[model samples]
Target chain A: MIIYGSERVEDLSLRCDVVVVGSGAGGAAAARVLAAAGAKVVILEEGGYHTSFDFKQREREMLPMLYRDRATQRTRDRLVNVLQGRCVGGSTVVNMADCARVPRAVLEHWQRDFAVEIDTADFEAASERAEAALGVAEIAADQLNANNRKLLAGAEQLGWRRSRFHHNRTECTGCGFCLMGCAFDAKRSALVTLVPAALADGATLVSNARVERVVVRGGRAVGVQGVLTEEHGDRPAARVRLEVAADVVLLACGAVHTPLLLQASEIASASGQIGRNLSLQPQLPVLAVFSERMVSFRGIPQSAYCDEHLVFDPRVGMTGFAIEGIAGGPVQTAGLVGASGRDHKRWMARFAHTGSCLVLVPDQPAGSVAADETGRTRIDYALQPDVEQRIRDGARAAARLYLAAGAEVVVPALRPLTEIRNEADLARLDDVAVNPDATTLLSAHPQGTCRMGEDARRAVVDSRGRFHGLEGLWIADASVFPTSASTHTMIPIMAFADLAARSIAQARAARTI
Target chain B: MIPEIDRRTFLRGATGAGALLVFGGALPLGACVLAQASDPPPDLAVLSPRAWATLACFADHAIPRGGAFEAGASDVGVAGLVDGWLVGADSRLVTDLRRGLALLEWGPLLLGFAARPLTALPPESAGAYLASLTTSRLGFVRQLHAALSELCLLAFYSTRSAWRAIGYDGPIVLGLAESVELERR
Candidate 1:
C-alpha cells in the first residue's frame, strides 16, 4: 500500500522485517527481491510518488517536480551537478535509461584495488538477470533518429568503433523526454516496473518521508526517524514525525545523498571514507548545427555510443572517456551552449538543426559528500587532472565528428571555439580547459561516495552491502561502488543490488542477522 | 556571511564560473555578499522599475534586435519571468543582482557619463557595457556578468517566444512516440 505520510493524523511508528530507504534502481530492486523472499517490507522515499502519467515533457514543469533541488544540486564550487532522481523511482525516473553492465576492467579494478570478490562471469550472470528484469535491449535500426544517425555515420566514417546502447524501454515513442520523467511510462524505470511489483507483493510504501538518521544503540541500528512534509510543496504545513524499525535498514540513496544521511547519523567510517571518494561521470555536450532539420528531440535521447576514444589504463592513472548522442529540450539546451547572450540566442535561433553529442569522462573518486548540522546534503567535488585531460581529448574528437557529419558549424564545449566550422578549428580545442566557465559541463552519474569493501578501515560497508561494524545496516545503491563504472550506471547498480539482496536473504535464512 | 541560500539554490549557466558556487562553499559567493549588501529591494516582488528596465535594456542587447527570431527577451517577458523565478530567492542574491544592475547604470560614470539608469543607454552602448563587464578583470563584474547572462539566456529561451526561434515546437504532447511511428508507417 502506498501512503502519503503527511496525510496521516498521528505520528507514524511502524515495524517491519526490512525497511529500504530510497526507491531508485538499487532500492527498488532490493525491495522487490526482499519482499518476494517473504520479508515483510516497508520503503520510505524522501520524494513523492509519481507514475508515468505524472510526467510532463516540459523541462520547467518537470525538473522542479521530479529532481532533487530541481536538478540543480551542485558541488561546492557549483561546477559539477550531482544529478539524481528523488522520487519513488529515484533517478530511474529521470535518467536516459542506459543500461550498461559493470565492464570487465571496472570489475577487475574493484577486485584488485578494493578486494571486491565478484569474478567477471558471476558478475555478468547477475547483469543478465538485471537486464532481463529491466527489459534491457538494443534499439532497432528503425528507431535511430536523424541526430543519432548522423553521430553514428560520423564515427564510422572516422573508422571509430561505436556501438548501440541497450535501454530498458520495450518500445520508445521517440519523444526525447526521458530526462523529463518518461511521460509514456515506456521507459520501464523502477517506478513503472520493480517499484510497482514490490508494492503489489504487500510491501508498504510511504512517500515524502525523509530519513533523518539511523537510530542506533550500542553500535547497531535500531530504526530510522524523520519528518514527512507535503509532497507538491517545499514548505510543510505541519510536519509529521515518521519512524520505522526493522531487522534491516537498506539505504539506497545515491552517492550524493547516502553519505549525507550516514554522516548525519554519526556513523563515521573507521577509514574516515564515509563521504569521500565521490566519482562524478563528468559529461559535456558538444553541439553541431546542421543545414538540414535534424529535430534531435523527435526520438530516443541517447542510443549510440563511441568508445573508440574512451581509453582507460589504470596502471598509469588514466581512465579514458566516450561520447554519446544527447538530446535536450529548450531550457537544458540553452544552458549547455555557454554563458554568452549573443551566442546562446544565435544557436537557439537555429535549434531544430542542432545535433549534439555528450562526452562522458570517467573521473576518479576525488570528491566528498556530507550533511551539515542542518541536515542539508553538502557536496565538495572537483575533477582531477586526468579527467580534465580526457575531456579535452574527447572534445577535440567530438568536434571532428560533427565536422565529419556534414555540420555547418560545430560548437565544442571549449569557450574560444564557440563555433568551429572546419578541421583546422579543431586544433583550437587542445587549449580548451575543463573549467565550467570554459565549458558547459554536467554530470548524470554520482558513485563511490559510500564505497564498499572487505576492510572496515578503507570502506563503509562489507562486500555483503552490510555497513562495517553495524548490524542490520546495509547499503544497496551506487553509494556502494568501490570505483567508477566508466559507463551508464543503472544496470550495474541493479545487478549489485540484486546480488546484495540475495546475500542478505541467504544470510537471514540462516538467522545470520 | 554568505547567508547560505541552499533552499532552491538556482545557479545560471551563463552567469558564473561553469560550476563555481556563488553561495556557500570554498568560494563563499564572493566572500560574503556583505560587501555589496548596502541597498536592498523593498518588496516581496523585489525588482524595482529601474532594476526591471536595467535588465530590459541589457536583455535586448544580449539577444539584440535582429536575425530570423520573431521575438527577443523583452517581448517574451524574460525579465518578468526571471523576476518571478527570483520571487522567493535569497535577498542577498537579489541584492547582488540589484547592485550589479545599479553598477551598470552608474558604471558608465566610470567611462565619463553622468550616473543614469542603464535603460537610458543606447543598444550599442548597453551591448558594449555588458561585454566590458564580461571581459572585466574584476571578479565582481565577471561573476555578475555570468549570473545575468545565464538568467537572460535561460529565461528568454524558456519562454514560448524563443521556441520557433530555436525550432522547438514546444511540448510533444501525448502519443508523441506513437504519432512519430505512425508517421513513419
Candidate 2:
C-alpha cells in the first residue's frame, strides 16, 4: 500500500519486519529483495511521491519539485553545487541514466587499502541482476545525438580513446530533459523499476515522510520517528507525526543525508567515521559554439564519453579525468556561461549552436559531511592541489576536443578562461587560479561518507553493510562505498545494495530456521 | 566575463583603496545615497524594500536591456521572481542572499570606486561596477557576483518570452499533440 503523508490526518504508527529509511537507488533495490523474501518492509521517503506525470520538462517547476534544496545544495564553501534528488526515487529519477560497474581496479584498491573483501563472482552476479532489472544496454550508434557525435568525431580525429556509454533507458524519445526528469517514463529508474516491484511484493511506501532520528533500545535500533509534511507550493510544511517500529533499520539516505541522520540520531561509530571520507567527484562544464546548428537541446543529453585522460593506479585507484558529452536546458546552460551583460547574452544567443561536455575528475576521499550548530547539513570539500591540476588538464583537453571538432570558440565554465579559440588561448589556462568562485563545478555522485570495510576501527559498516558496533542497523546507499565507485554510481550502488539485502535475508531465514 | 584578477592584485591595490575609505571617511557616502527616496514593489514576499531595490539594480546591470536580447532581467521582473522563490528557500540561504545584495548595493562607495550607491549610479557605471565584482580579488565578493548573476540569468532564461532570442523551442513535451499521460500517483 502507498500512503501519502500529506493526506494523513492524525499521527501514524506502524510495525514492520524491516524499515527502509529512504527510497532511492539503494533503498528501493533493497526493499524489493527483502519484500520478495517475505519480510514486511516499510519504506519511508522524505520527499513527495512523484511519477512521470509530475515531470513538466521545465526547470523552473521541476527543479524545485524533484531536487533537494531546489538544486542549490552546495558545499560549505559554496564552491561545488551538489545536486541530489529528494523525490520518490532519489537521484535515479533525474540522473542521466548512465550505468557502469565499479571498476575492477577500484575494487582491488579498496581491498588493499580499506580491508574490504568481496567475492568477485558474487558481485558479478549481483551486477548482472541489477543490469537485467534496469534493462541496461549499450547506446546504439544511431542514438548518438549531434552533441555526442561531436565528442566522438573529435576523439577519433585526435586518436584518443572514447566509447559509447550503457544506459538504462528504454524507448527514449530524445527529449533532452533527462536532467530534469523523464516525462515519458523512458528511463527505467528505481522509481519505475524496483520501487514498483517492491510495492507489488507487498512493501508499503510512505511519501512526504522525513525520518528525523532512529529510536534505539538497548544498543539496537528499534524504530524511527519523524514528521509528515504537506506540500505548500514549493515548501514542505510539517504536519502530523510518524513513527515506525521495526526489527531492522536500513539507512539509504545517500551519502550526505545518511550521515546527517546518523548524527541527529546520536549514532557514533568506533572508527569515528560516521560523517567522514566524503568524495564529491566534481565535474566542470565546458561549452563550445559550433558554426552549424547543433540543436543540443532536442536529443539525448549524454551518450558518449572520452576516457583518454582517465587513469587507474593500483596504489591510488581511479584518477586522472574523463570528458563526457552533456547538454542542458537554457536555464542550466546559461548558468555555466560565466559572462555578464552583452557577453552573457551573446553566449546564450547561440544556445542552438552550442555543444557541451563535463570534465569529470576522480578525487581521493578528502571531504567531510557534518551538521552545523544550526542543525543544517554542511558538506566540506575543497579541491586538492592534484585534483585542481587534473581539472585544468581536463578542461584544456575538452576545449581542444571541441576545437578539433570545428568549434568556433570553446568556453570553459570559468571566468578567467572564458574564450579559447586556439592553442595560444589555451596557454591562458596555465596562469588561471582554480579556486572557489572562479568557476562553476557540480557534483551529481556523492559517496564514501559512511564507508564500509572489515576493521571496526576504520570503517563505519562491515562489508555486508551491517553497522560495526550496532545491532539491527545497516547502510545500503552510496554512503557505504570505501572510495569512488565509478564515473557513474547507479549500477554499482544497486549491486552493492542487492548483496547487502541478500545477506540480511539470509540472516532472517537462518534465524527463523 | 571580465579578466581574472587574483587576490595578490587586490592586496597590492588595497592600501590605496583602504586609505581612501578610511581617511576619507567614505563609508557614510553609501548610506547617504541609499537614504534618498525610492519606490519598491509592494507585493514582494521575502526581500525587504532596500534589498529588493538593490537586487533590481544588480539584475538590470547583469542583464541589461538593448543587448543581444530586447528583454533584460528587469524587463522580465527577475528580482521579483527571485523574491517569490526565496519565500520557499531555507532561511539561512535567504539571509545570505539579502546580505549579498546589501553588499552589492554599498560596494562602490565602501570600496572607494564611486561616491554613490549602486542603485544611484547610471546604468553604464552600475554595469561596470557589477562586472568589477566578477573579477574582484576577494573570493566572497566574486561569489556574491556569481550568485546574483546566476540567479538573475536563470530566472530570465526560464521565461518563455526569452526563448525566441536564445533559439530554444522551450519544452518539447508541451508542444506534442498527443502526449502520453502517465497514471498520476
Candidate 3:
C-alpha cells in the first residue's frame, strides 16, 4: 500500500523483515528483490511518488519533487553543481538511463584489496538479468537526431570505437525533456520499473518520510527514527518518530546521504571511512552549432559512449570516458554560446541547428565526502592536475570530432573567450585554467563514499556489503562500490543490490532451523 | 547595479510573443532593476535606467524576433521578470548577478535612468543598434552577451523550445494516433 505522508504514526504500525532507507536505483531494486523472496518489506523514500504525469519541466517545482534540495543541494563551497533525484525512484527517475556494467577492473580492484568476489562472469550474468528486467535496448540509430548522428560519425572518424547506448526505455519519442523528468513515462525509471513491480507484490512504501537516524542498541541496528512531514511540504505539522524493529536494515540512501545515517548513528567510526573516497563522474560538455539543423536535444540524452580507452595500467589511470549527446533551446544555447550580445543573438538564432556533446570523465579517486559544520553532508573534490588535463584533452578531442562533422562553431566549457572554429582553436584550452570553479562540472554518478573493503578497520562495509561492526546491517548502493567503474554505474548498482539480497535470503534460510 | 528594462518593451515579450518566449525574453533584466515608480516596481528599486536598457537589449537579442516569430523580446515584460527575480528573492545567482552588474561601466547612470517611465522606441532602431555591437566595440556588450547567453541557454535548455527543437514525441499532444498508441500500448 502507498502511504502519501504522515498519518500521525501509530506506535509501531510498520513491521517488516527488511526496512530500506532509500527508494532509488539501489533501494528500489533491493525492495523488489527482497519482497519477491517473500520477505515483507517496507521502503521509506524521502521524496514523493511523483509519477511522470505529475512532473513539470520547471526546476523550482521539480527540484522539491524530484531532487534533494529542490535539486539545488550544493556543496558548502557553493560550487560543483551536484544533482540527485529525490523522488520515490531517487536519481533513477532523473538519470539519463544509460546502463553499463561495473567495469571488470573495478571489480578486480574490489576483489584484490577488499577480498570481494565480483568476478567478471558473475557481473556479466547479473548485467544480463538486469538488462532483461529493465528492458534495456539500444535506441535505434535511425531514431537519433541529426546532432546525435553527427556525434556518432565524429567518434567513428576518430576510430574511437564508440557504441550507441541502449536505455531502459521502450517508447522514446526523441523529446529533449529527459533532464526535466520524462513527460511520456517512456524513460524506465525505478518509479515505473521496480517500484511498480514491488508494489504489485505487496511491498509497503512510505513517501515523504525522511529517515533522521538509525536506531541502535547494544551495538546493533534495531530500527530507524524518522519524521513524517506533511505530504508535499516540509512544515512539521506533526512530528512522529518511527521505530520499526526488523531482522534486517539496508542502507541504500546513496553515497552522499548514506554515510550521514551511519555517522548519525555513530556506527562505522572505528574505521573512520564512513564517508571517504568520493567518486564524481565529473562531466564536461562542448556544444557545436552546424549550418544544418542538427537539434541536439532530440535523441536520447546520452545515446552513445566510447570505451576504447578503459584500462588500468600504471601510465593510464582508468578507461576512456563515455560521451553523451546533449542540446537545448534558445535560452540554453544562448548561455553556452551567447556571451557577447551578438554571440547570444547568433547562438539563439542557431539554436535549432546546435549539437552538444559531453565527455563523461571519471575523476581519479582523489576527492572525499565529509559532513559539514551543520551536520549536513558535503562533498569536496579538487580536480587532480591529471584529471583536469584529461578533461582538456577530451574537450579538444570532442571539438575536433564536432568540427570534422561540419560543426560551424564549437563552444568548450572552458572560458567563453575560447571558441573553436577549427582544430587550431582546440589547442588554446591547454593554457586555460580548467579548475573546478572556472568550468561547469556536473556529477550524477557518485560512488565510494561508504566504500567496502576486506578489513573492518579500513572499510565501512564488508565485501559482502555487511556493515563491519553491525550484524544484519548492510549497504546495497553505489556506496559499497570500492572504486568507481569505467562505465555508467547504474547496471553495476543493480547487480550489487541483487547480490546483496541473495546473500541475505541465503543467510535467513541458513538460520531457519 | 544593472539597469531596468523598458516596461513597455518587456511586456511585449511576455504576452505578445507567445507564452513560450517569456522564459528567454525576460531572463536578463533581473540582475539589478531600477524601477522609478513609487516604491520601485515592487522588487526592482536598485537598478538604474541604462542597466534596464542594456537588459532590454540583452533580452531582445536573446529571444530575437523575425522569421515570423510572433513574440518579440519586449512582449514578455522581460524587464519585469528581471525585476521580480532580483528583488523578490535571494539566491546565489541573484547575488552574483547583482555584483557582476555593479561592475559594469556607467552602472550608476543606467540604474538612475531606469527610474523614468519607459517609452517604446522604434523596433528597427533597437534592432540596428543591437546589431552594431562587436566584441571590440564594447566589452560590456560582450559581457551582457555572455550573461544573456547563459540565461537564455538555461531557459532554452530547460524550456519548451528545447523539447520542440529536439522533436519530442511525448504523449502531451494527444492526436488520434497518439490516443491509439496510448490505448494500444
On lDDT, the leading prediction is: 2
- Candidate 3, A415-469: lDDT as tens digits: 4457889877877777766642245566778888887776878788876578887
Which of the two, 2 or 3, has more TM-score?
2
Per-residue lDDT tens digits for candidate 1, residues A258-316, read 88888788887787888888888888789899999999988998988888976657652
Expressed as tens digits, the lDDT of each residue in A1-513 for candidate 2 is 999998889999999999999998999999999999999999999888998877888887788788888888788777688899988999999999999998888888888889887887888899999999999999998998999999999999899999999999999999899988899999999999999999999999999999999999998998899998986434477899999999999999999999999999999999999889999999989999999999998777899999998899777789999999999999999888877788788888899999999999998888999987766677889789998999889989998999989999998888754699998888877767676667858899999999999999999999979999889999999999998885799888899899999999999999931
lDDT over C-alpha atoms for residue A444 of model 1: 81
Q: Can you give the DockQ of every candidate in the order shown? A: 0.25, 0.35, 0.11
What's the true lDDT of residue A4 in model 2?
94
Ten contiguous residues minimizing lDDT sum, candidate 2 chain A: A229-238
Against the true structure, candidate 1 reaches a TM-score of: 0.88
Candidate 1 residue B169 C-alpha distance from true site, Å: 1.6
In candidate 1, position A284 carries an lDDT of 78
Q: Can you tell me the DockQ of model 3?
A: 0.11
Model 2, B1-185: lDDT tens digits are 11112223243434444444344343323322222223566798998776777788877777877677787876677888778766676666675675566667768877777887686777667767887887787776776777778787778887877898889988866633324333231
